[model samples]
Target: MYKIITDGSCDLSTERAQELDVLVVPFYVSTDGINHQKEIVELGIRDFYQFMIDNPKVFPKTSMPSIQDYLDVFGPLAKDGIDIICICITTKFSGSYNSAMNAKNMLTDEFPDVKIEVIDATVNTVLQGMLVEEAVAYKQMGATFEETVAYINKIKISGRIFFTIGGMDYLVHGGRVGKLSGIAAGALGIKPLILLKEGEIFNNGLTRGRKKSKQKIVEQIINIS
Candidate 1:
C-alpha cells in the first residue's frame, strides 16, 4: 500500500487528514523567540491568529520540521514495507523537502526494498493542501506514483494564489520586504498583494486598504479565469 504524508502548511484539518488516511508533520512557530510550538499540533489556527490579534507588536517566526520528526513517522511505515509519498511546502518558505529527503536516505539503508518519494509542493497553505488532496485521489484511483508526481509537478508550475497581509511589519520581519518599503506602506495604510510565481514570492502591486486588497484579489482571479 502507499502512504501519503504532508506538512502542516497544507492547512488540512485533522478530521480531513484522518479521513484521507494522510499523515501531517508540523512546523514550529514561536511568538516568543525562545519557546516553540508545533504549528497545528500545539497551536490551533484560530489560536495562532488570536495570538496575532492580541499581540500586534510580536512577530511570529516559523521553523521547519527536523529530520527526527520525519523519522518518527516515516520509520514505522517503512518498516512495514509501505511506499511513501511525502509532500512538503515549497522550499521558498521552508526546507522541509530537504529534511524529508534526509530522512528517506537514512531509512533507505535499513529498508532498501521500500520506496520513498519526497515532493516539494511549490506552494503553501490551502494551495499546497490541494496538491496533497490530488495525490490522495490519484492513489485511490490506482494510478502509478510516477503519474501522480508528474501531474502535481505540472500543476505546481501553473498554479497561482493571491494574498494580502494585515500589516507590513510581518513581511519585514519575515525578510520578504525591505524595512523602508514596509514602513512607507504601513504609513499610507497600504497592503501589498502578494503571489507566488515559479516557486518564489512576488509583490504584484499595492492597494490602499484591506477591502480594496480583497477586491484586487478577486479581480486578479477573475482576470486569470
Candidate 2:
C-alpha cells in the first residue's frame, strides 16, 4: 500500500485530510514582533486569517520543516512496508520542497527498499488538495505509483487560484509591496487584487473601494473558472 504526505501550505482542511487519510507535515509561521509561532494547520484558517487581520504589524514569516520531522513520518511508514509519495509546495515559493527531497534521500539510505517519491505541486491551497484527491482516487483505482504521480503533475499545470486582500499593510510589511504603494493606497483607501501564481503572491491592481475590489475578484474567478 502507498501512504501520502503533504505540507500545511496546501491549505487542506482537517476534515478533508482525515477523510483522505493524508498525512500533513506542517510549516511554521512566525511573527517578528511576537515569539508566538503557529503551524498553518494548527491554527484553523478562520483563526489564522483573523490573526493576520488583528496583528497586521506582525509581518508573518513562514519556515520549512526540519528534516527530522520528515524522517519521523517517512521512516516509520517505510519500515511498516508502506511506500510514501509526498506532494510538496513549489520550490519557487518555499524551501519545503527541498526539505521533502532531502528527507526522501535520507529515507532511501535508511530503508533502501522502501519507495519514496516527492512531488512538486507547483501550486498550493485547495488546488494542491484537489491534486492530492486525484492521486488518492488513482490509488483507489489501483493505479501504479508512477501513474498517480503523472496525474498530479498534469493537474498542477492547469490549476489556478485568485483572491483579493483588503489590507495592503501586511503585504508591504512582508516586503511584497513598496512602502510608497502601500502608503498611497492607505491614503486613497484603495484595495489591491491579489493573485496566487506559481504558489506565491502577485499584485493584480488597485481598486477604488471594497465593493469594486470584491467585484473584481469575482470577475477574475469567473474568468479563471
Candidate 3:
C-alpha cells in the first residue's frame, strides 16, 4: 500500500486528513515566545486561527518539521512494508521540501526495503490540497506509489492559485514584497490580485478597493479559463 504525507503548510484539516489516510508532518507555530512542531490535528484549526486573530501582533511563524518528525512517521510505515510518497509544499515557499527529501534519503539507508519518494507540488494552500486529495483517491483505487507521484507532478505543472490579501503586512514582513510597495499600497488601499507562477508569487495587477479587487479576481479567472 502507498502511504501519503504532507506538512501543516498544506492547510489540510483533520477530518479531511483522516478521510484521506494521510500523515501530516506539522510545521512549527511559534508565537508569544513559545514554539511547537506538533500535529495540526492536535492543535485544532478553529482555535489556532482564532489565536492568530486574537493576537494579531503575535504573528505565527512556521518552520519545517525536524528530521526526527519525518522518521517517526516513516518508520512505522517502513516496518509495515508500505511505500511512502510525501507531497510537499513548494520549496520556494518553505524549506520543508528539502528537509523531507534529506530525511527520506537517510531513512532508506536504515530500511532498504521500503521505498520513499518526495514530490514538491510547487504550490501551497488549497491548490496543493487539491493535488493531495486526488493522490489519495488514486491510491485508494490501487494506483502504485510511483504512479500517484507522477500524477501529482502533472497536476502541479497546471495548478492555478489566485489570492487577495486583506493587508500586505504579512507579505511585507515575509519579504515577499518591497517595503515601499507595501506602504504605497496601504496609502491607496490597493488590493493586489496575485498568482503563483513558477513557485513565486507575481502581481497580476492592483485594484482600488476590496469589492473591485474581488471582481477583478473573478474577471482574471474568467479570462484565463
Candidate 4:
C-alpha cells in the first residue's frame, strides 16, 4: 500500500491524520527555552492558542523537522516496500522539504526498489491540509503516480489563502511586520489581511477590526471564485 506523509505544519490533528491513513511527522516549537513537538503536544489547538495569548512575553519559534526525523519515518516504510508521497511545508517558510529530500537521497542506495516522492507544498496550515486530502483521495482512487503529482501541481497554483492575525505582536516577533506598524495596529485595533504568494507571505491590506477583516477575506474569496 502507498503512504501519504506530511509534517505538523499541515494543520491536521493526530487523530485526523490516523483516520486518513496519513503519517504526520512533527515540527518543533520552542517557547521559554523548551522545545515541544507539535504532533505529540498535550495541549489542544485551542489551548495552544490560549497559551500564546497568556504568555505574550514568550514568543514561540517554530522549526522544521530534522533530517533524522524524516529518516525515522521514511526508513521503515522503504524497508517495507511501501511507496511514499511526502507533502512538506513550503521551502520559503521552512526547511522540512529539504530535510525530507535529503532523507530520500540517503535511503535511495539502501532501498533501491522503494519509490519515494517528495513534494513542496508551497503553502501551510489548512491550505496544505487540503492538498494532502486531495492527494490521499487520488491515491485511494488508484490514480497513477504521475497523474497524482500533476494534479497537486495544478491545484497548488490555483489555490489562494487569506487570513487575519489575532495579534500583531506575533508578526512583529516573527519579523513579518515592523515594530512600529505592529504597535500602531494594536493601538488602533487594525488587523491586516495576509496572503501567501509564490510561497511567501504578504500583507494585502488592513481592516479596522477583526470582524471586518474576516468579512473582507470572505469577500475576496467570493470575488476570486
Candidate 5:
C-alpha cells in the first residue's frame, strides 16, 4: 500500500486525514514570542482562527518543517516497504518542499527498495487540501506511483486561488505587502486581492470594500468556470 503525506499547511482536519489514511507533518507557528507546533490532530481550526482574531497586534509566524521532521515520518514507512507520496506547500511560500526532498535523498541509500515521490503542490490552505484529497483518491483507485504523480501534475496547473485578508497588518508585518500600501489601503477601506499563481503569491488587484472584494472573487470564479 502507498502512503500519502502532507504538511499541516494543507488546512486538513484531523478527522479527514484519519479517514483518508493520510499523514500530516506538523509545522511551527509562533504567536507573541511563544512557539507552538501546529498539528491539526491537536489544534482545531476554530481555535486557531480565534487566536488570530484575539491577537491582532501579533501576527503568527509560521516555520516550515525541518528535514528531520520528514525523516521521522518517512523512515518507518520506508522500512515497512510502503511507498510514499508527499505533497508539500508551494516552494515559493515555504522550504517544506526542499526539506522533504532532502529527506527523500538521504533515505534513498538506506531504503533503496522503497519508493518516495515528493511533489511541490504549489498551493496551500483549502486549495492544498483539495489537491491532497485528489491524491488520496488516486491512491484509493490503486493507481501506480507514476500515474498518481502525472495526474497531480496535470491538474495542479488548473487550480487558482483568490483570497482577502481581514486586515493588512499581518501582510505588512510579513513583508508580503508594502507598509505604505497596507496603510493606504486601510485608510481608504480598500481590500487587496491576493492570488496564488504558479507557485507564487501576488497582490494582483484591489477592491474598494469587502462586498466588492467578494464580488470580484466570485466573478473570477465564474470566469474560470
Candidate 6:
C-alpha cells in the first residue's frame, strides 16, 4: 500500500490527519524563537494567536522539520516495505521538500526495494493539505505509487494559494514581504493581499482593514474562478 505524508504547513489538524489516514510532521513553533513546540501537536492555534496579540513585541516563529524528523517516520515504514509519497510545502516557502529528500537519500542504499518519492507541492496551507488528501483518495481507489505521484504533480500545476495577512509581523520577520520589504507593515491601515503561485510569493494588492483582508482573498478567488 502507498503511504502519504505531509508537513505542518498543510494547516491540517491532528484529527484531520487521522481521518485522512496521512502522517503529518509538524513544524516547530515558538514565541521566543528558542523554546519550540510542535504545531497543533504541542501548540494550539488559539494559544498561538493569543500570544501573537498579547505580545506584539515578538511574533510567533515557525521552524520547518529537519531531515531526522522525516527519517524517523520513513525508517519504520520503509522497513516494512510500504511505498511512501511525501508531499511538502513549496520549496520557496519552506525547506520541508529538501529535508524529506535528504531523508529519502539516506535510506536509498539501505532499502533499495522500498519506493520513496518526495513531492514539492508548490503550495501551502489548505492547498497543501488538499494534495495529501488527493493522494490518500488515489491510494484508496487502488492507484499505484507511480500513478499517485503523477496525479499530485499534474494537479499542483493549476493550484494557486491566495491569502491576506491579518497581521504582517510574520512576513516582516520572515524577511520576505516582497514589494513591502523595507516598509513598516504595521504602519497605517494598509492591509496587503498576497498570492502563492508556482512556488513564489507575490504581493497582489492592498486592502483597507482586517475585515477587508478575508474579503480580498475571496475577491481574488472569484476573479480567478
Please give the CA lDDT of all the candidate structures.
0.89, 0.81, 0.83, 0.85, 0.87, 0.87
TM-score of each: 0.94, 0.88, 0.93, 0.93, 0.95, 0.89
Which is better, 2 or 6, measured by TM-score? 6
Q: Per-residue lDDT for 1-225 in model 6, tens only?
A: 768999989888788899998999888998785899988889976677788788887877788999999999999999999989999999988898999999999999999999999999999988998888888898898899999999999999899988877667666766666537425556666788888898998889887788888887898899899
Tens digit per residue, CA lDDT, model 5, 1-225: 789999988888888889988999988776656757565545676677788888777677777899999999999999999999999999988999999999999999999989999999888888988999999898788898889989998899987898877678988898877999889989998998878878888876888888989899888778778
Q: Candidate 2, clashing residue pairs?
A: none
Residue runs of model 1 more than 4 Å from their true location after superposition: none
Worst 10 residues of 2 by lDDT: 33-42
lDDT per residue for candidate 1 within 1-225, as digits (tens), equals: 879999999999888899999999999999899999998899987788899999989888889999999999999999999989998998877899999999999999999999899988888888889899998998899888788877777777877888888888778887877999889989999988988866788878889999999999899989988
Top candidate when judged by lDDT against the true structure: 1
**Would you list the clashing residue pairs of candidate 6?**
none
Q: How close is candidate 1 to the true structure, as a TM-score?
A: 0.94
Model 2 C-alpha lDDT per residue in residues 1-225, reported as the tens digit of each score: 889889888788788889999998987776564444547555675677677788766667777777877887888898998888999887777888888788889878878878888998878877788888888888999998888878887668876777777777777877877999889888887988877766666778778888899999989989878
- Per-residue lDDT of 120 in model 2: 85
| Stretches > 4 Å off in candidate 6 | 177-187, 211-213
Question: Cα lDDT of model 4 overall?
Answer: 0.85
Best by TM-score: 5
Against the hidden true structure, what lDDT does model 5 obtain? 0.87
